[model samples]
Target: MYLLTLSESKPPNIVFIVADDLGWNDVGYHNPEIKTPNIDKLAREGVILNQSYVQPLCSPSRSSFMSGYYPFRTGLQHLVIISFQPVCLPLNISTLPQELKKLGYATHMIGKWHLGFCKWECTPTYRGFDSFFGYYNADEDYYNHSLSRVPFKGYFLDYRDDRQPVRDQDGVYSTHAFTKRAESVISQHDTSKPLFLYLPYQAVHEPIEVPKQYENMYPNIQSEGRRKFSGMVSALDEGIGNVTAALKQKGIYDDTIILFTADNGGWVSYYGNNYPLRGGKFTIYEGGTRGAAFIRGTGITGNRTYDELIHAVDWLPTLVSAAGGSVTGRDGQDLWKSISTGSGENRTEFIYNIDDDFPPVEGHAGIRYYFFIFFIIPMLPVLMGDYKLIEGYPGLFPDWYKPDTEMSSLDDPVEEFMAREGYKADNGYQLFNIKEDPTEHNDLSTKNPEIVAKLKARLEYYRKTFYVKPNFPILPDFAADPTKFNNTWSPGWC
Candidate 1:
């Protein structure tokens, strides 16, 4: 990989935009049904990553992106941190914003900050961002600015400005408000110092609410849920357009590095669609791990597709390297050359998931080395090059709730649909050449016992050596009850 020569001139401004629960086909570039002109423009002017992977869920993905390390290494491998959870990103560990802050950059974060907020020290402002304007929970009401967790009583206003709650923000559409905040930040930025703006928009997620204008934009969408979901995405797209326009108006668009990606795959129950890929959110399938990603900016080569494998953890080191900063002892690789120049693959190994439970199942986990993948959970799908082995069905398989039929339930209809379709799992270990069948419709395991044996052995080795018990104590469900744990105090990490 070629080292990026730091320009004698000022360092380029970095604008990192992350979308919440955006499906693979959610963008106009991937599906004509979705009207995402702003994101489409990025695809036209930058490189689209076809094989970008992230954690199966949001908090884990965000942690990996911020830390340049696997979730397992950071003690954030499991589920999302609930509101008031004592657990948080360890204070000793450095973050992307911290690195940028060290390089004389003005770091600002607008929108979601779901990593942790149990203590004031765990919030964005304390973790490297100079200013933070957004909510601190996994999700909040788009318009009311209130969290929706069942046990949390009353309207817990989640909107905040730097650390203080902004009670007046109620009734403001979060997507629009966040965009306006970003524009304000850009307009007020000190040009003498480069800017590191992180905009993680809460769009197309649950409680899909949109402005009336946006809601009426898609009259043809039969499913009301899907229609609302589309509206949320369109709103986000418009917000992106506004942000980019602000950058251009400031004469900094050409000098800014813009990286856009979804936090993870779509949550199908919420009308998010990851078509042509089996499984959705909360599974180890491609639908849960793979996401839509692109990078466009001054120094990047435009109008290209980079099929090289990349993980969420790679962004911290990659962006830090591009900013002329050093990132040592991180799992991420400086993929600046691979991403910008179409250079050969920069990452050959990826351990996507390592759960705390032994013989991980229902909760899926796995690892990939080059073209080989060893899925250690329910379905032991070991993929070596093009061929993949599946010992059984993923424990949590076929939640086949279709938008056309069971949209109202918002629950798994996979079993009913499977029985109706007369679908059956292969009796023994199954294999397929994914290169030829991206949909994984064919099985060739019985014919290739030797390959299966070799991969199984490798899987065993990984389980014994690479896997470790989760470091942090799992937060108890009582943590969600404000009365039981109302105090703001930092909890010790393992």
Candidate 2:
């Protein structure tokens, strides 16, 4: 049963850097812009996962990354955990940090903790992270500490070492401060044990504000918001450079596996470019869901580019495998061996689930219940080819509703319907050979009915398994009887 004998094999230390709302083409390695020499160096010396992916938003992606389960499984879904909402993750699941802890690695998270707000179960400490700091809300003002979206009055600052809050400092920008805390944690942690650092930032998300020094770096950028974004990205790049240098200085650069990626596709409206792809955040389109993922250090090298289609859910199994831990129960396979040993090829086929709410299961409601059952709850096996079928209504779910609405409307229907059964597009269910069209420019639904049938079956299974239930008329009891609510009553997925 002891698959790994605790051999003297040095388990690689992990430093995961996740940028907030970064675009697919934001990094120089993807397409040169704004000079990221440090990140570029990582690509030059490491491997670029050309098709790595994450959730379309920040919190769920983070949840998926940490828990090694789809965000829906973790109950994060499309919703960002607000402080007032429950800060809980499902207790039955095992988290990546928890797995690493069993291997004697110290796990720490510095920066955004939007996965949970006040829920007792959702705290990072409870989820296997040994230490935590930063905001529980999705976005915060950079300099003034103001809440990004108004209506919620009076926002102050909070800093935490574990789950406990510390006095907020005046004049401190969240990004710079979080980075400094991370640097301090890295420098001061027990060096004898392996370390897992999950650093998710709040930079470039919203309320465009850059440190005065970084602000001047983008005078050449035309638009005001874009210039601010560029400045923020530059600062993040500098932070990476500093962090990597710190690793080198500590003599652990080669012993660590540093993974850098974005939580989702860019906000094109923010002047962010997800070039060659259609749509942006909140859509199931490639641009909104596809992301940047790369790995450097230890057994990974050569700056090789992989065209595999990977999702955020794979991180858990991949890291667990790389760390020589048990991943048999995990949803994802150990991608490390495949990528490193050349035994496996790039992944093909993927699903993008963007429903707003979580499906009612056992009469319970988590904010992300709909997302959990639909996208995150499904089995993800790599395909031999690039053919994928997307169920649910194809095309954009018009942003006609406010961002706060949990579900989208179908054709301005008087009532909401979670299940889009027997629904046929004029073009039929859209199909795409992603190998030929990663951008999804051409809809092959009309041309390929066979592919549609295959994908539709898969999609139907996905629906039957997860979204058979619906949201509650009232905020139903999530803990008592989650299955009492069903889609037949009032299923709403717009």
Per residue, candidate 1 scores C-alpha lDDT tens digits across 216-251 of 888999988888888889999999999999998998
User: What is the alpha-carbon lDDT for the whole of candidate 2?
Assistant: 0.62
Candidate 1 TM-score to native: 0.86
Across 360-453, the per-residue lDDT of candidate 2 in tens digits comes to 1111111110111224556654333466455444333212221122332243221232244222222234566666777777767678777566
TM-score, prediction 2: 0.80
Which pairs clash inside model 1?
Answer: 400-414, 431-444
- My TM-score estimates for the predictions, one after another, are 0.86, 0.80
Best by TM-score: 1
